[model samples]
Target: MDIHTLDLNFLTDEAIASFVVESSDGPVLVETGPHSTLKNLERGLSDLGYGLEDIKHVLLTHIHFDHAGAAWALAQKGAKVYVHPFGYKHLLAPSKLYNSAKRIYGDQMERLWGLMEGIAEENLISVEDGTEIIVGDATFIGWHTPGHASHHIAWQLGDLVFAGDVAGCKIKQGPVVPPCPPPDINIEDWHASIDRILGLKPSRILLTHFGEVSEVETHFNELKEILQDWAAWMKVPFEQGRDPRDVTPEFQAYANGQLKAKGLSEKEVARYDAANPAWMSVAGLMRYWKKKLGA
Candidate 1:
């Protein structure tokens, strides 16, 4: 019933995080950052007097590189990975996903993601919404909370929820920002997912991008408002047929301005973008608007 946060130190300090749930059965890992940070994850586990081999269950919020890149590697060590059913195929044979990411990252692929391999099908446990997984004395329930990605799931245990990107990303004592990555961003679905999380009435939420959020209501309300505002702002650019690249700077400025007003230092603002790039939001929001227009 104890949770530990692992700062992956991905690209910047406190950018990406993984959670470890210590149970009587074994250690359960939630969100494996990227494969590039696997060594740091190992070090984190070691710090807790455990090792990678000690992990028995790996629960992923989704298969996005930042969240599940190290999942296959952990599975290789005999851990059973639990993920949304929609992502099972990709993990079973990740070549297509790798190629797709390579197309975007190109030269930075290896440095950003490390080695991504296909996980054995037998090692994967496809979970549905409302699925309950019991590990030792703890109970974890999976809620299919799509919006950030169709495969996204927020796991709940007691009054705590492991809300990956569905609850948005907020650095400690900083403004919360929605993680709108492209190719599958759905604003409507995201809104519903946010509502679903709220219905859970969780007292605390743990985010994969950073750490725990104790002010659950305020955090989620602000996240929903900001998410809608960003999407609404991008709608205009998309309607005018403005290139995403051209509008990215404007979006970045607006987001940075908000962070600055929140008393975040320049370095802290940089870490926010490093955690969830503003450009990806531009591209993602544009895609969402375009899809709505039937373009």
Candidate 2:
């Protein structure tokens, strides 16, 4: 099984994806970056001696624009796109997804995501937990891993697990950061998902934010700690009657300080900042807290 990392130069650098298990039958493209970086994705595939036509199955960790936006393009090439069942309808008709994103991104939506057209129903496939999908010679086991989003899935191929945001965001030199995106960020569920992935005992974890991480135990431990920290910090502001908007900057500052304490150099810290922005997680964390407390 061949795994290729396609670095989709989104707004920031290092927002890469892993195209794993490529063979004559066809290559499985995981995480299609954003619609704006389709050219970069195509170039990456071409560099590997394949094209959109060679991708028979596109496995999405989640349906976030940055991760699964270009899957629509691949679907046009007759590739079967597989995503979580909860996210299936949204992909078929991205109006709600686009409108929700527009609320957060506003004017930057087009610039950041380009155009996200709906994927044809015929080319769309949905899988729940414990569902095994065979694409060519490779077999991927899907686990309904939520926490990052209610519609997230973590695919296991052989001893390697394609952990989307379930493992959190770990960039070089920075501490493992949790991406608790809004609408469905459950702290308890996130912790359970981590345990579920760990139980699989995969040899390597292919993180969507960057490359492969072999330090499975240490990596999971770090992610668990950071997730708790972020959740705990976000809860305090809410309990103290602080505005969500005001708490965002505080969370950013706290996260930056934590990164600095982890001994990330200026250059390494810059990469972390570029790869995973603190505001995005802040919004998610705030949203999670609100839902948990019924605020």
Q: How large is the C-alpha RMSD of every model relative to the true structure?
A: 1.0, 1.4
Query: Going through the candidates in order, what is the number of backbone clashes in each?
Result: 0, 0
Q: What is the lDDT of residue 62 in candidate 1?
A: 97
lDDT of 2 by residue, 170-246 (tens): 87545688877787899899889999999999999988887789998899898898899889888887777777777
- Residue-level lDDT of model 1, residues 1-295, one tens digit each, is 7889999988877788999999999899999989999999999999999989888899999999999999999999999999999999999999999999999899999999997999998899999889999999779999999999999999998999999999899887788899998888998999899899989999999988789888888998899899999999998899899988999999999999988998999988988888778889998889988888866
| Residue 250, candidate 2: alpha-carbon lDDT | 75
In order, the Cα lDDT scores of the candidates are 0.92, 0.84
Name the lDDT value of residue 169 in candidate 1.
Answer: 90
TM-score of candidate 2 against the unseen true structure: 0.96
